[model samples]
Target: QHGTPSSPGELAHHATLSFSYLWAGDEWTFTDARGAVTRVRVDPAIHASNGDLLRDLAIAGCGIVMQPEFIVAQELARGRLVPLLADYRTMDLHLHAVYLSRRHLPGK
Candidate 1:
């Protein structure tokens, strides 16, 4: 496994796997304990739209991947993946659910 990066400045030396389609996923933002934000630009070694593929690539020692915790929970638990840069918080990824209003819509 690629060793943990203690600081944002060290990330440029390692390969990074990305799962972004819109952006190149090159630049990453993180928050520190003092609520300071740091942006690090990593070298994108591989780009895949699928999270699973990124996880697999990470597990195989191809590169570091910044993904949702759920996607790599098992690996982390089994010691297959080790978290890095704990002092900094990665970009918060969110998902929203939108549903139709039953009161305004006709019955299906």
Candidate 2:
């Protein structure tokens, strides 16, 4: 993947391929060091509701995917998938946990 682009402008010269997931929208947005934003609308090569499947496809060299760090952490550590556009930051994803009242919680 020596020809792979590291910047948004260069990426545009290549096919904007991606693997689709239900929660992930059609756009891949990145904010650069100068605070400039780049929004990319991907041409999906595979559409899957499962993140694992998407990650697998990416590992198989199907196409590029924007997956959560936790999901691809092992692959990244093993050098299976290389990080791109390190200088840019992606949008933050917020997660929330819900449970019953504290009174219903078990005592430890």
Candidate 3:
């Protein structure tokens, strides 16, 4: 991934990640495949206070928010958030990027 670092002032290989339904809500109402809802937690989202405010919103018992793998892989791996209903079909988006068009203007 582009986030990875190789050596001093150098970049290595790159990898593409994936994203899906970005589920975020101030209040979360979890339900099972049988259509049963469960209790919800009411706490201030820490991540919201930090850089990724939306992340804390999700951690604070908000609705399941899905984001790109690259964007959340670290948080997910660290158990900060849990994936819900993996079997269910979620949303997806097609993203593409190109080199900055404004490059070589003066900072060269």
Candidate 4:
């Protein structure tokens, strides 16, 4: 964790943290400024389903974690965690808020 990598190629040498519930848990995908896509296969030393746990591990310098910005915002701001590969774009996964109409509600 001393020398944080600044490029996608450097990720292979570092340890990774994977989310067990994510569809592409072991695969990290990125898009460069040139619109080139690169997929990296990471063998995580630790796998977990909880984001909080992964954040904790990353904050403790266990390994790099791919987590939502909201989850690690505080730690990152406080310098407890550092953001890497700022130029590269990762997958944009979002949580959608769904609402059901009365007709679609239970036994309508």
In angstroms, give how far residue 56 of model 1 lies from its true place.
0.5
Clashing pairs in 1: none
Candidate 1 local lDDT, 52-98, one digit each (tens): 99999999999988998999999999999999888888887777899
Clashing pairs in 4: none
lDDT of 3 by residue, 10-102 (tens): 111321111122453323334445655543432322223233545555666543344556665778899987654453333344668868788
Per-candidate TM vs. native? 0.84, 0.76, 0.41, 0.84
Q: How high is the lDDT of residue 57 in model 4? A: 93
Where in model 3 is the C-alpha error above 4 Å? 1-51, 102-108
lDDT of 4: 0.87
| Each candidate: RMSD | 2.6, 3.7, 16.2, 2.7
Candidate achieving higher lDDT, 2 or 3: 2
lDDT of 4 by residue, 1-108 (tens): 547887877788898888895578688998999989888888888999999999999887789999989999999899999889989899888689988667856873
- Top TM-score model: 4
Model 4 misplaced stretches (Cα beyond 4 Å): 98-108
Give the per-residue Cα lDDT of candidate 1 at 82. 94
Report how far residue 83 has shifted in candidate 1, in Å: 0.4
Report the Cα lDDT for candidate 1: 0.86
- lDDT (C-alpha, whole model) for all candidates: 0.86, 0.75, 0.42, 0.87
Worst 10 residues of 3 by lDDT: 8-17
